[model samples]
Target chain A: MSDATEKEGRGVRAVETGLSLLGLFLDSDGPLSAADLALRSGLSKAQVHAYLVSLQRGNMVVRDPQTGRYAIGPFSLELGMSRLLTLDPQITASEEALKVARKLGQSISIAVWGRYGPVVTAVVQANDQLLNSAQPGTVYSVTGTATGRLFAALTNEAEAREIAKLQMAEVTPPRYVGACPPFDEIHEPLETVRRTGVSITYSFPQPGVTAISAPVYNFSDELELAVTMIGPAEEIDISLEGNHVAPLRALAATISRKLGFIGKASGA
Target chain B: MVKSPERQRGVQSVDMAIRLLEIVRKESQPMMLRDIAVSAGITSAQAHTYMSSLKKFGMIEQLGDAGRYALSDATLTFARHVIRNDATLNANINVARSLSAEIQEMVTVDCLVQEQPTVIFAVQGPRTPSLSLRPGTRSRIGNSAAARIFDAWSDTPEMNPNLSRIIRASGYAHAEGTPVPHLASLAAPVFREGALVASISVIGFPDAMAPEPERPVLRALLAAVSSLGGSSA
Candidate 1:
């Protein structure tokens, strides 16, 4: 419960009830009038009317004369995006990953180099004909999944080395070397990804699977997240057949630019 | 109809004035007093009083002619401010913009109102193909992708039983022909400090969006939206 809610407890049920009324108009096709709103919220006619009046006063609910209804005000959008900007990497990457999943018809996932090597915080799976579904909080073995390798490869040297050290310490028999492509070979894909600014893979994590991953740029040029496409081997062909690579690169690049990553030096 | 009865009682003046301002706002240039007054629903006599106050408040102003009022730049600034200061619904601009370009489909941000669902914001790319999407468009609550996501997130922390089921099972919501007919969408809730806050969604037409994987996409968006909610907040 919010501290305010906790503090008010039952005393402020009206505030909670009022917010519920406001929530209703947030997506109302048009502004809502106090009477109809009262009917919908099941609140007493007087209470709903009072809340709507108060809402208009606060600019949270707008009274549109043309339609004579109340809809959301500009303040609502501010609240939405303000929450959006806080976690730049996740929102940017997940939206892109959904595209990859939709196109590839396979599970696509996003990974970030967190304190625990590469963690798969988000996943989008193909609704049909799939294996290896992606789930949030599903941690990839540093050497475990393509999304993992992609992020592992993309990290700056120092972070990569540390993650590798962390991985080797955690995994039995050590993933520091052979299990994952040797740090030296990992660079080939990593550099290809960095230089070309896109990451691609085939049959990673398991046989008959191919995937593509890309970096997400935030309101700044800083590398915030990665988007990957995972799919069955045959379906992977469809992705390659289309000009998917170029669009993915362009898409990722555009997001980067929007995040204020305008420098050509980091355009890749 | 959406405005409360309390709002109807005496605030019509304030409401009409805001409407006149909006009428002036839609066009690139100033509008004549008749047009503004017609839209705002006040007599030219009553409008004169409202306009005078609006002008002083910097919400509207006279252009080349004394009777012509145009939206002032201050309105846009105020819009940006109102959008920012408002409670709870997050800005879907960059996310929607990026999704439109990236997905090559209409991207929308929606919220749940009165436990009903509808689209609050719709951003379409020049390339986005859509039959039913525009700014301020309306849709059924909890019926479409954007609606489902918004419904999921906007649920009070006390938690609606249905919403809790959707969030726990899928982490987001999905629907094929909800807010818009034949439009496909995958939507995810945005959470703030564990409370559902707003929603983000990607939309496409029937031909473009096959349903099987849409749920996963919703899940992915949910995780990311939560992150965005954290940092953006």
Candidate 2:
């Protein structure tokens, strides 16, 4: 190779290493110290600091002056929002959610698989009363809500199981009003969803609320988004074959087709 | 020629790559190579090198027959990571969601982003209010309760000479029927480690949302803020 090509390769490698450091923050639970990053990324402490200084300069990472720990920066968020503005799933789901909310007269939320877990992207409240718990940017638990369980059931299993395990670990018993379900226990519910193509949770994640959720798939026949319809528990029928589930499942199928999911119709 | 002090210290290529990415970020449309090159004041060949690295990482995408480039999926991944990893933001978002759920009123979390009071999170009330604010909505200085809360607690310049004094005394700011007709809002500051970090605001109709210091809505708002380690007094 020419000398110039070698130098260019080194430059690219530097950029790649710097970006990998930023990627670590995505997987981490919170802001990380330089030493923590160095340990996780398998780089020397001094090398990690050098890359952090570069990432910080680029506004890819920010160091809290008080704590000296690094977190992802706002510039990255602007870039993310720019990409999300054109995302096909969110746009289609938001429109479809509004329509479903209008037709059914219930609050609806559209959740897509964000980097962390299922993050709400759009919410359409019914006209009569408010269901304010689910808001855009709220990340649902993989094992907790209907929207979350739908995604957890439909997506890749190992990743879903891992996320479920972490969430179960974090859950307190008091929140469940009893012993929180064991990590292995979610398998049965998820398996049922895989067979049924819909997930339901009664008065969970919020009391007096029942949510029925279905999945939207992309061209690759992969789970792309989960559309959940929430209403008062006493009013919403919890049966898998009930009137409420039919419209929600139908809406998910319609959205899936719009997204080019040509596999056998969902919930089949 | 000597490099500027800012550019001289960090990795140069990473700096250039971020600059090119920012140029693409600022444009609404997918930009051609030459446009990005011109925007960054770099040669097309030089810009191509950086663009190649960014595209390799899925940070920028070249689209269609024209080869116009735009920010790509990696940016969203990074953005979500940033949003998720910020412990304080997540706690505040939880407070907004639960408070709105509890009070049956719209609640929002606002913070000063780049010196502008911006809505970082919002939860809609049960009863459909006249105005529904979305995340990323920027609040103006004079009329909004959030702006007033920031002025009262943070370094933002006070809009009213006595506004900060009154808000400081009351431990919250109230704006009624001004920013939008018939809308009333109560906003209280949230402090983490004694520094004003955000404002939690409840907004709704005037009849249901009277701006009283001892009202249940204001108490709930203050309680939520206090749970975040914010002192209302």
Chain B TM-score (each prediction, in order): 0.55, 0.81
Complex DockQ, candidate 1: 0.03
DockQ of 2: 0.21
Give the alpha carbon lDDT tens digit for every residue of A1-268 in model 2.
3654566677778787888888788667679999999999999997887777777877788888889898988888667655544556677678777887888788888887654558888888875777547677777777777877787787655566666666566634322111235546678778889999999888876888888989887532346778889999988888877878988998888776554444432232
Give the per-residue lDDT of model 1 (tens digit) for A21-136: 76565334445687889888988877666666665764557777876677766544333232222224466566666775576455666765555555667877765765655566
Candidate 1, Cα interface RMSD = 15.1
Candidate 2 chain A: worst-modelled 10 consecutive residues by lDDT: A171-180
Q: Give the alpha carbon lDDT tens digit for every residue of B116-167 in model 2.
A: 6777666555453546365556677566888888877766565776878888
Q: What is the lDDT of residue A177 in candidate 2?
A: 16
Which sections of candidate 1 miss by over 4 Å?
A1-96, A143-145, A171-179, A238-243, A250-268, B1-233
TM-score of 1: 0.36
RMSD of each: 20.6, 13.9
* Strongest candidate by TM-score: 2
lDDT value, candidate 1, whole model: 0.54
